[model samples]
Target: MTASVLRSFWIGGFEGADHVNGAGEPLDMAAATAHLELLNGDYLRAREHGLLTVRESIGWRLSEPAPHRHELARAVQVATAARRHGLQVVWTFMHYGTPPDVSLFDDGLVERFASFAAAAARALAPLHDEPPVYNLINEIGYVAWAASHTNLIHPYVGDPQGLGEHTEASGYDVKRRLVRAVLAGMDAVRAVDPRARFLHVEPLVHVVAPHERPDLADLAERIAGYQWQVWDLIAGRLEPQLGGHTGALDLVGVNHYHSGQWEAGTERRLRWHEGDPRRRPFGALLQAAWERYRRPLIVAETSHIGVGRARWLDEVASEVANARAAGIPVEGLCLYPLVDRHDWGDPAHWHHSGLWDVDHDTPLPRHRRLVPDYAAVLTQWQARLPGAPPLPIAPPVPEPLPESRANGVVPCTT
Candidate 1:
């Protein structure tokens, strides 16, 4: 049989956003999730739950602190664990974490990124029997907006130039650089592995004019268009741009969440549930995305915090099924942060959003316990998927431990 692009329709992703926090402390999710230490167990847990495809990030800063000099220890461990557990991994080359020395606005950023990609491809080739799938940079559009528009990264608005800090104007420079880096990185990776596939993952959002500010509808629509700019440039739809052609894009990996929709002028987040009239149906948005790009798509990232978690997953499964039946060519739905993660800015705030609820208070992989409510819903959803296999029976734990300190995902579900 020909090798499948993804092992199954339902996939799981580790939250690998390696960004600098507000206090200038580095936040490494790989460390937070206890991924490297229990990497095999995590893969095993996903496999038993019938999630054979996993998404993970290889930290750019940790892997290659300097240009040209590459380190593949972490990436290799992740790949090896997946291979051993019979899983297909969606590797992300850069998850919002760039080396300290590499500046996003510098002229040579593209070249440096391409070199890094080529080095990574060469290093990862031995583990994979086929061309590996990659999300080159997780949500570059968001990254650009955060860096230029918000106080997230460098080039803050408070700089001495009197530049308009948090507006659309700041996005031009950073967005262009991100596009160039992707275009250059694609060429470099393809040079090493001809069959390599890429996913341009961007956050999908909806904007509505506030009741009192109907005139702001246009502004909301314009901001919504920002989501498509990166894909547009790659598809040759953006005019006066270079290196973009019809087939430049391979897949559309959209990262969406309950908070995606918001007021246009005021930017107030609209509640996705509770029958909000302004909220658009997920299937409708998926259809729109398909009509525009004409490429296979995946819900790359999605989850809700607290009790809304199970309800959200059920809704997403229904939408994905509807889209597939309607011939949208929808590939998969990934449960992002399969292992729970802590807040980037405030460590005290736990999202409680993962199938596995991890304890972020204690240091070291802390405790990754299964959220029984969410896992049950996920298992049922998987059974209804096309080509989904029977979930393997989990091995019994030596003794009953408190729910707070459960070790593996599947075993904890009992």
Candidate 2:
């Protein structure tokens, strides 16, 4: 019997700015591109490797420094190149950067973003008829984590002792505005090509020990609210508490990472690890999500920093397969940063998470080391390709007992 196959690929590089570390050392694009070309080889490389999709983001800051004006030559060059190569593009409107002229907190940021989205959609619609899929913001929770807790980027100062109120408020506002921008962008693209799809990406957060911190339990509920609230507002299931125009998203994008678990009584000691049992597995997360929303799900980003990334990819691909076998509408999985790049604002070398190792002094694909794992994924799923026999499903687990007695023993006579 064969299993279902899910296509895997990646979104590569940030636009406008060259890949750089937290210390601001710029990577050599010429050298990096040459290296990437070898791994995926221009057009033939990616296509032959079986990647059905590619992800890219247009920089709002770079494209439109001022209101209503767009600098699209570079964007057009990239998008055109991707199309010529036969790769489907999922273009993100705002990955992290905002236009220098607009303040995200401002009352009018939503309107400004909508207008910008419209302009972007208008410019890109001619190249493709598939209504453009727009990722309103990448990892909304992580953005808040960086800005509010880690001080990794703008609005650097945050009140950590205050349960991240400032960060939460800021993140909520930015996300609300971003969704509005996406809807506006979709409308704009639809005017040119009416099939535009909107995608919203949020980080997956897991509470490791709910019993330890009562506050964290409350926080967990709030975080889930934050994650899905924007979509609900857009879909008209809930009222818009944040100040932004409302409309439901066409797809929900998930930017899951290895380090998503939150352990109570260990807040300060929380560290990113690969095989933590307390962490919610990606398969479980996706399954619960599919059952809840029943919409198409895409793994927007996943990559490992050290030599273990290959193993990480295997685990993730298997999870995707499992999800698909269980009847979940799993669309794609993206190994973010096709080649390793510098951490956005962290210059201390704190986060070296990428598929390729950047410490090589020259960028190159880690494929030689990673190919085996990639091949394992390919082989596992390829066997399940169309027309192949369906794979057998695993048996379900039994439910737990209802209650216990006072003698530290339950009345279990089964």
Candidate 3:
């Protein structure tokens, strides 16, 4: 039950972020995207497209709706569905949202999270024959930055709307607490099932000095350097009090997006399409992560909205291929939000960022129409990667759509 292996190089990620938004309303991306209701079809399509592995998450708020009490019916349902589809799962225990009573700054957060983790592990472990991968927390840096620094989620800054200045000190505090919670949760899960494998997922980004702000070069470098802090902490290279050690850093999961590269301290994003020399190659980022931790890497999350989706897939897939050729052990690339989602801040706004777009007119389990262009790009890349099953038929021809409609529906965030 402890064997470590991935059936294919490609993985699909269900958008399972169940967090309270800036407006103080709970948002469930999986339900918004209809992934839960359409679970069977989604998995069948993923396997059909050669995506044999998937990234999934348990809604902590739902699983542990109350303090010290646990209910994992949905968690078991997802595990059963994955097993039935013959897919391997990468389970995320905490995805930003937690029980309302649990506070990030509280001493009890660590213990509460550990208890919930052990409960979930016991409930789901028997479904799989091989060791199941578990990500204790998804995007630790982003969660900290949101909850403490800025306030995109809970622990709002000034007013209830969560609009206010960033707290530098609070940011560090939240990060450490989150790390400790992960360590504790890992130990608990291991106690329940020793075969469990852990994945440390963090955002991978590059920062550069704006041409006008040459004086801020060092600051920009420091910002870019922050990406490694969490991994270091997990490996006991930093903040040894958090109970971090080498074994805690199992599989390194990096979440990168089109907006991942940017000009430090400014609104300008370093253009990936344009020849922004400041922009680093995706392969280089992967190589750097591998060199730093020397662990098997996974592009845990990556996708672009609208018309940019196909091109983004092509670029990411190419970079992954190049990295593997250069001997970087990138186990897989997950096309996240496998289905398009409605924005958390604005539910009316939909980001056509997934391989399949949603039709609003349809009922619960809405219609999922595959984006022909994206499918074509995926098919091309799957043929190049080893272990990917060949598609039985060619992807449909893409329907031409205006770039404005495809990419400009709404400004990208997160």
Query: Tens digits of per-residue lDDT for model 1 on 174-201?
Result: 7767776777777778778867788889
Candidate 3 ranges beyond 4 A from true positions:
1-4, 158-170, 362-365, 387-414
Tell me the tens digit of each residue's lDDT in model 3 across 365-412.
Answer: 489999999999999988787443222222122223234323212111
Clashes of 1: 0
The model with the greater lDDT, 1 or 3, is 3
Q: Against the correct fold, how does model 1 do in TM-score?
A: 0.89
* All candidates: TM-score: 0.89, 0.74, 0.89
Alpha-carbon local distance difference test for all models: 0.76, 0.53, 0.79
TM-score preference between candidates 1 and 2, better one: 1
**Where in model 1 is the C-alpha error above 4 Å?**
1-4, 154-170, 387-414
What is the C-alpha local distance difference test score of candidate 1?
0.76
- Please identify which of the two predictions, 1 or 3, would achieve the higher TM-score against the true structure: 3
Q: Candidate 3 has which clashing residue pairs, if any?
A: 1-131, 306-406
lDDT of 2 by residue, 59-165 (tens): 66666767778776655766677677766667776665666666554545555666677677777777764446667566555554454454344444444464432
RMSD for all candidates, in order, please.
12.0, 12.3, 11.2
**Ten residues in sequence with the least summed lDDT for candidate 3:** 405-414
